[model samples]
Target: MEIPENYPKKYWHCHIEVDTGGKKNTSAIFNDLTIKELWQQVVSPWHTHRPFTVDGTIVRDYDKVQKIKITQTEHPQSYYAEQHNASMQRKGIADMATNRRLLPLSKGKDYTHEFLFADLTMNDNEQEKVVSNNKIFIVHGHDEQVKETTARFVEKLGLEAVILHEQANEGKTIIEKLEKHTDVGFSLVLLTPDDVGATVTDKENLKPRARQNVLLELGYMAGKLGRGKVCALKKGDVEIPSDLIGVLYVEIDAAGAWRLQVAKELKVAGLGVDLNNAI
Candidate 1:
């Protein structure tokens, strides 16, 4: 069947049944149509078989579907799949959707009433592993004091601090290395003044800024792990990126108040943090 141009290209496995008096009901599976388009172009047309009786007493209309079981599959039809694949390839894997695996369909809990949908791609065990991640990526600049302090703080909370340079290169590029180590549940960005920069028209009026690589990794971490999972520790006076306005940044003060703030953020991000550890 030629799908409508406007309809979504998802493939659905639908189990439908048409009412027929005492005799056997007409049951069929339509595998190539989206639920919306299937209802409109196919099921709706069956309305002409109206006023049909089931079990010799109950009356029903074909349009008034008695039961609909729909399970969306992994890929669309070839034509739609090709189009989607081309678009995704152009955007690259970094921009691609999360990876998912389809599971075999199983019977629903109440076998008589409904069919159990496919199991979610990520099971409870996988989700628990992600949520229970104990490592925190540390995106730092040239400020050794700030970096060490932050790493120590994370360790105090019983969490591992993933410093990029400390990890094995294994012949991987910088970005590739970063990607490999981004399996952590949270990221701590150290924004320290390691460089000076100003607009093209104002060369002499340069201001303090974090290292270019530090800023790049900060953005990368923020994107990989959501903003809530990434926290920035601003040390001294550094030029903050305008694009990262909404990100949380705790100031590195002499009184060590930043530790408590960071610990709280970590707790909010679902990490196991003891606030007393910060003390």
Candidate 2:
């Protein structure tokens, strides 16, 4: 077999000889094989053919075996490669633990931990204390009327509305500011028809749409907070984004029916909302 130039220079060479009393020994030699590959290609097949007894019970259809012997020799290059790999694995694990401990609680959500460790353990009450449940992030576009009205309604529900631009810039970029403020438990996306666009082929047939920034923030909020915790308020003749098919979109009609819908969504998302206040 041709080996790639980057392949490990050393490997365990294995020789297996099986003697079933009736016949001559059957033997095979494999060169440049990893320990796992040696077991899978050679040892496992023999074990399957003649399974060892478990709890003094014989497996069905087991082959009668006399003697089976396996010999393995590790090349010097392979031994060094194994040692290097093991050391790197140990260092990687240590670095991951250190990084996890150094990351702030707000940024910890970005990392995925497969197993629970002592440093990462937190009770439900502790987690609730870290994340604010009463704050609602409002992702708005160019429509000041809709933005102000939505902010007012959110505040009227006895909850704090987090408006991005209203917060101090603090010498951070827009995305950085957004990341700092997205710790809220819920988000409200205002999809006002602030722009118009159409496919390249049908440039003349433009349709009203929300600003690109609004859609970008909408997606970001939906991902940060789950779709159930994010609600989109469509105002006027704005075209709904096709990608957000499963997300909840409430119509902001002139008669003010959207307030009740928003209040219901907030209540379902574990926010304290007074339905009567919405009406």
Candidate 3:
């Protein structure tokens, strides 16, 4: 593999949190390195080690090193956050901690733990790679809370949430990756005011709108999966295209409230979701 030139302009700000129980944890590191390189350098070394047991939990740090969370900012949501904290990639029971019996062995307490590696890094390109998984493609602008909440909600429903910003696409562009990952069945677009657009003839009039990239993704989704398979959850003041009049853009002040409607739509699209029990 060709090594990426460490661009002087692109310095990654990272924050690592290492917890070994007893309420002790270390802060993340912010430096001039990509998420992939950090995994190979810092995380991999101390993430998991021998003995295979610590304070009732299985692996030391587990995937805390392997699966790095990518974002434009330090916040949790911004764009394609690591939705599924527990990666479906791990194969056997050795790596999968939740598969075995509960640790600490509390009858009524139900204490469970997994490596949540939320830190600095950028995957040039990423989405859920599982072809058989219930993949929900979440598209958004700069909102972090909505994206993070959406990812958690999707995982709560036992479905795979495919996030773009967390994957390493090495040499390809975002548009290229979208064309490649066509196995996705459903899409949730988050529209927030991040940009202002005015027509060429009417330069004086400016209105709240999503970023150009978000618009491009939305248009791509409409063409690739049809309007029925996509839902736009607009949070703030934003204007959309007139052609998308038939598309459903639900207005909401918050994020998690739209799960029921989104789940219902996913069910109709043949995802086998039970919205009745979901809250």
Candidate 4:
């Protein structure tokens, strides 16, 4: 076969630099040949061997090296890309670690220690798993302590809570995380001044985050699934956005006594079922 100039073919070349004999030792060299040629070169000086020939070609086992030369370097992601990548990697590591121990002990031919599925599929599956695992509520409000306390209250009812605090911290942005919540069966947003003000105008001059990521998420749920799948959890003091006038909102206090009530709301929303429990 004709080898292309760009083909990355690597071959093993062996030679001996040390020798021992009755007289002074001599060095021998062999170029681009098999182990047999190397041995012959070492032994030929002494006239102690018969005819020798290399048995095989070194270029035969170079597919991996060849492929490596053709592979492109991986490019770094933008800010958003980095956020999504980190989230994906984190979830992958978590799922792999958790499922690693549960994997079958049998040495079956089909069993594998590492899974090589698509990252998108794994992430989407993780989101679905999260939604079905427990009742989840997305709380957004002006007062950090108040909104957080409400989420904590929801957690007290044995539910999942994700409090999108108004303060933009060093963590992942709201839009980055919301895209991964595909199977988010139910969500609740606490619309406040900070949440609305943080939104930026897009090229279309539309306020994407006007209601915060919670609002974008709600819009996604409404458009994809329907309006019944999401709720608005707001304190009585804040004015509700005009767009969310008809949506349901669960009002909670800072004392964390409303946990059971939030759990009841989640049950009413039909997101209290655990779908991943069987697997």
Candidate 5:
């Protein structure tokens, strides 16, 4: 069935995402009508009735005449994939809400959340002085002292740092948490002996080491921002993984020399570091 024009339908578009491994993993579209039709087609065979989720973001608007710019992104991590889909749905609804002006949708029956699309290309007349800021996410192991020392080191450097102690939960899986938070300005992975042995097995019962998760997180980010964005910090002389041979890292030593070394390296890489805070 053709979607009604006045009933809040938007332009349609599709794209494919590729990973650093050059694999085309997933494809998606940005039309409200097409998505609903597809959902019907999937359920019509089974005769079970329920709304479908490609992810959490749902397609509500469906327009056929309008054309949207389609950009294909390859090899995006889970974090990026969710963001990209949400952005498209928001944009589609925003067009209907504001007569083509890039504005938040009005709160009403047709739309749920208001979406604000800032024109990134349009330069603002007023610009504020930029302060160089860096946020480092610390993925810690079971070692409390190591976590605290790392936090203290980050505190010394004047950079905003938060040590994430991830415990397995039924709601938010460890993998999801890592993927969700790994895309910060920088990530500090404290690799412990226990962490190296940690592994999540698949249906086939094949188990990989736990350190593999950290590598996957780094691999996902490196695919987007390149190699320098991620760093592996050695807690106590753990052997580097074969996959991480190309990644640059610092070794932790007595008196916390590794912290100082990392701070220096970050600054050299154009990441602003507060030397006074590094005390």
Candidate 6:
């Protein structure tokens, strides 16, 4: 028997997701009804397929699922070993498949769904573009002038600019306030030497760096939106953490030429930017 490249070679495989919040969970795919019905018989709380409508944005439980590829190829030996052990594995898979009310941890239920052989129009890259085309977050500490300068540029370019400062504090921790805007396509971290710190052992020498909030926000933005979408603008000789040694940065000198550099990053982050357009 010849297996054509386009042939639907069926096997029980799970589409495990690698989420931005550092969680790995599975969403299964059952090829035929017999398998789905068989699992229903064994699993305590069984799930029958629901009517799914395919629109431009996948509507799963009233949320949009952001599609991502299965980055891992190898599965645990338990998922492969069959017979007695297979029963537990199947049950575990079933539980994961149905235990879905909301995934609030990673920004709460991004119905941006995808799985192997699942019917959907767009791919992962297209989803990224569509989702990231909205806003850009600017993280700063005690540099209102700099923030105002940057915000003006972002607005003139025709995109929404977000600042952690504008968010309602309401006694919320700094992190909680910042993460509320995690859906932004990109982040700008202003590294102005606003705060000075001394080493524990030597209190004599002072170091110039951004505030602790700025540093923490930069690291968080790098992890969530990814390093490529996060930019560090240096207005002074701020200490660059070793982990962010290779991240992109634009030095702001008196010449004020950082505009073009920042614009380039915005263009990639989904803004329809014209580099020639003077900022």
Provide TM-scores for the models: 0.59, 0.56, 0.50, 0.38, 0.45, 0.57
Expressed as tens digits, the lDDT of each residue in 18-43 for candidate 1 is 65554765654445556566544443
Residue 183, model 4: Cα distance from true site in angstroms: 2.7
Q: Give stretches of model 6 more than 4 Å off.
A: 1-132, 169-172
Evaluation by TM-score, superior candidate among 1 and 5:
1
After superposing candidate 2 on the true structure, give the runs of residues whose Cα lies further than 4 Å from its correct spot. 1-131
Query: Which of 3 and 4 is the better model by TM-score?
Result: 3
C-alpha RMSD by candidate, in order: 18.4, 20.7, 21.0, 26.8, 16.1, 14.1
Q: Which 10-residue window of candidate 3 scores lowest in summed lDDT?
A: 103-112
Q: How many residue pairs clash in each candidate?
A: 1, 1, 11, 0, 12, 8
Ranking by lDDT: 1, 2, 3, 6, 5, 4
lDDT of each residue in 1-279, candidate 4, tens digit only:
111234222221222223233354333322333323332332221121111222221111111111110011122113334544577688875333322211111111220111111122223444444444354546463457656765665565556665444334556665555544433445666654453232254444423232455566666655533455566655545555577566766665565344445455566555553322211
**Candidate 5 lDDT, 155-244, residue by residue in tens:** 667676744444345477666765544434566777655543423553454322326555566566554334565666776656567777
Identify the leading candidate in terms of lDDT.
1
lDDT of each: 0.67, 0.65, 0.57, 0.40, 0.46, 0.56
1-279 in candidate 6: lDDT tens per residue?
A: 111234222222222232233354323322122223322321111011111222111122212233322211132223334332456577775333422212211212222222223453444543544465557788887888999988887777777788876878988887777766665767888998898888899898888878987888889888766677789999878777777777789998777688888888878655677776635
Q: Name the runs in model 1 displaced over 4 angstroms.
A: 1-70, 73-132
**lDDT for residue 203 in candidate 4, whole number 0-100:** 46
- What is the TM-score of candidate 5? 0.45
Worst 10 residues of 4 by lDDT: 64-73
Candidate 4 shows a clash count of 0
Candidate 3 C-alpha error for residue 79, in Å: 56
Clashing pairs in 2: 10-78
* lDDT tens readout by residue for model 3, 77-122: 2111232223434432235444122211211111012112433233
User: Where does candidate 4 stray beyond 4 Å?
Assistant: 1-137, 163-174, 193-214, 253-261, 271-279
| Candidate 5, residue 226: lDDT | 45
Clashing pairs in 6: 63-111, 64-110, 64-111, 64-112, 65-111, 65-112, 65-113, 66-112
Model 5 Cα displacement at 222 (Å)? Answer: 3.4
